[model samples]
Target: MDPAGGCPHAVNARLRTRGAVAPVVLPGEVEGAVVLGHEALKDFLAHPDVAKDPRHFTALHEGRIAEGWPLRTFATVRGMTTADGADHRRLRSLVSRAFTTRRVAELRPDVEALTDRLLDGLEGAAAAGRGVADLRRHFAMPLPMGVIGELLGVDAEYRDRLHHLSSRVVATDLGPEEVLAANRELPALLGTIAAAKAAHPGDDLIGALIAAREEDGDRLAPEELIGTLVLMIVAGHETTLNLITNAVRALCAHRDQLALVRDGRAGWADVVEETLRWDAPVSYFPFRYPVRDLTVGGAVVRRGTPVLAGYSAAGRDPAAHGPDADRFDVTRSARPEAARHLSLGHGAHYCLGAPLARLEATVALERLFARFPELDIAVPEHALAPHAGFVGNSVRDLPVRLHP
Candidate 1:
């Protein structure tokens, strides 16, 4: 947990305890260190020259290569979010059309229906003398998985396997050999799904992607197709899962806010937005390296220095969010204001599933609170297990008692 130890993203706990923004400096006495905050970090993310390709950082690349991780395969290159220039534009445009606000709006009915069904299952379990249930397993995890799986045409039977594959792919602390093993295994599994979709066309994202590939004739590469599918599944499930669990926990801790949500005085949508700001599901974007030498907050970031934008820190920036930035205010009117938080990221690589994530969270919260108005945490917050070095900060299990 030492700030100066392994992860550069780790801030000094002592500095945080002092109630101030932690400064991130370059090694040695650099003239200007990156002063990360809402405004400064926003400028950094908005800067056209602050790129995302990891190849910009030769040292990081060499380190990974020395560790036996694949440098140019699905681990890095094939992923659409990592691409730049014409490639990034082309892929993003194609994918954006599918995730348009209109398209996501159409999926809202299905999201609500799925939420209702999950709530029914939870109610049944509660009635059967199972006084408490892990909301993480019963609701948070499955709701997003089902929605995303339907979008991608992944079979219900294989959804569990896909979830397992996603966990392996995004693991940060895994050794080089372990990461490589995941890289090898993911494609084979996805290849099977791709072949199935190719043989049997269906009304799903994967089918649409396959059709697009066929019509375009080499425009959409096989690796790109599979990687996009994997990204959608992983991105869709992991973030929203945490959003639901975190929102529920936040509500439990604040009974007044829960009452507001239950009585419809405050919309559940506000709760969802506030929860995202309070404790974001995806704490940081994957490592982004500068393509050219750049200055952020007066710090000279050489071309090829790795930078991880701190979304968690940015969410709590006092200037952007006011002095009470740490307070979770569901009634806060500025929730939708632009530059609120980098949870969905900024610029071209911004999350493609933002609309769907919002829809799922809204629907999940509406149904959950309506069903169990007296829901309470089964264990103290500190007792819960935390997911470590993962894309989302998820509770390993969220046990809650549902009072009928």
Candidate 2:
């Protein structure tokens, strides 16, 4: 069946036209390839043969490390992103308790309060000038930093520095020397935070991790602790920042849906979900290598083959999402089974912070609309600055007019 041209496919076509290469899909599939590389993408994500080590993908590895960014230390082994099997389980187990539904719900009040504060700052900025502001700077960027900073025990004073370090590290265009610098310096920074959390334990995630390390004994190494903390701070902030920006951009592009959300006729949560599906912040995850030879979709995947799963492509598959899959309709009730948008990922490597991400987006969107009832784009949509590369995609700046 032919797609009516919406969401993922529409975006995928743009990417393809811009020189992004993907596997060729068969006739029946909506995308170029249903079984990208060797097997179905979902199967590859579930396969134990497929490992998350970026080292297997030589080009990506060299490209990221070529730069001397200090945050690379955390990226190389920090958190659950690189871990597989028992190590993945151990790291996930340690932090799993902190991201529970109850915890996310408990944090809603704080999220709302933080959202309000951010809007207050944006309002002040806009009022002082032309009643216009860059949503990325004033709203999207800082909200996640504030929320995740408090969550990870990063000192309030150092949030800006951490944000700078994180941005440089994950930046796709960085050279090897720049990436290496970030990889090296991140540990010392995180080490200082770990010490502070150790000395004066707080009710934050870092403090909890330190306690867990001390009580468990050998459960988590010092490097692992630094890595996990870095992961939480960096990943938590960058991804959420993009998610907020993408959501706003999508709503603005679809005026009717934006009006629906603004008028309170549609559920904000559903709108957020659709936004994630429509223009996900993290477009594609890095390749996972196979530990052994495997056959997928009649193709042979040799050992150590790198497989890149297309989240952007999968979410927009017309076969899975119906003809209007690409349309941003807040009233559209997404099926749980069909909602398997690769945005949060799949299988064992699924995102640990999904619940928290949803909570933040829901709170942020509701507060944003409620505050700036007359918010609209200040610049032409095509003029928006977008961060390019395979790791993450987001608007660099979102200039918008806010009417009180």
Question: Quick one: best TM-score, which candidate?
Answer: 1
* Top lDDT prediction, candidate number: 1
lDDT of 2 at 240: 89
* Per-residue C-alpha lDDT of model 1 across residues 1-404, encoded as one tens digit per residue: 22122222244223344233233333222121233466766777677886656566556555533434322232264667677777777676656776889999998888888889998888776666478888888888899999888888889998888877677666555556876787777788888988999899998878888777433465678888877777787888988988999899889998888887667778888898888877778654445666777766555677765565556666766667878877778877544653467767777777888988998998898888777878888889879876645345656789889983
Model 1 gets an lDDT of 0.70
Model 2 alpha-carbon miss at residue 361, Å: 0.6
Where model 1 places Cα greater than 4 Å from the true spot, the runs are: 1-36, 60-77, 126-129, 213-218, 334-339
- What TM-score do all the candidates reach, one by one? 0.87, 0.85
Could you give me the TM-score of model 1 versus the true structure?
0.87
Can you list the residue pairs that collide in candidate 1? none
Query: What's the true lDDT of residue 31 in model 2?
Result: 22
Q: What lDDT tens digits, residue by residue, belong to model 2 across residues 1-404? A: 11111233455765443222344321122122223221256676897777776555443454633234322342366568778887788888888887889988998899988898889999888887678888888888888898888878788898887877777766545556766777667667888878978899999888888877523465577878888877887778889898998888887778789887668788889887787776777665555666676776446655554455666665665656677766777776645545456678788978888999898988998889777767888889778756744446677788888873
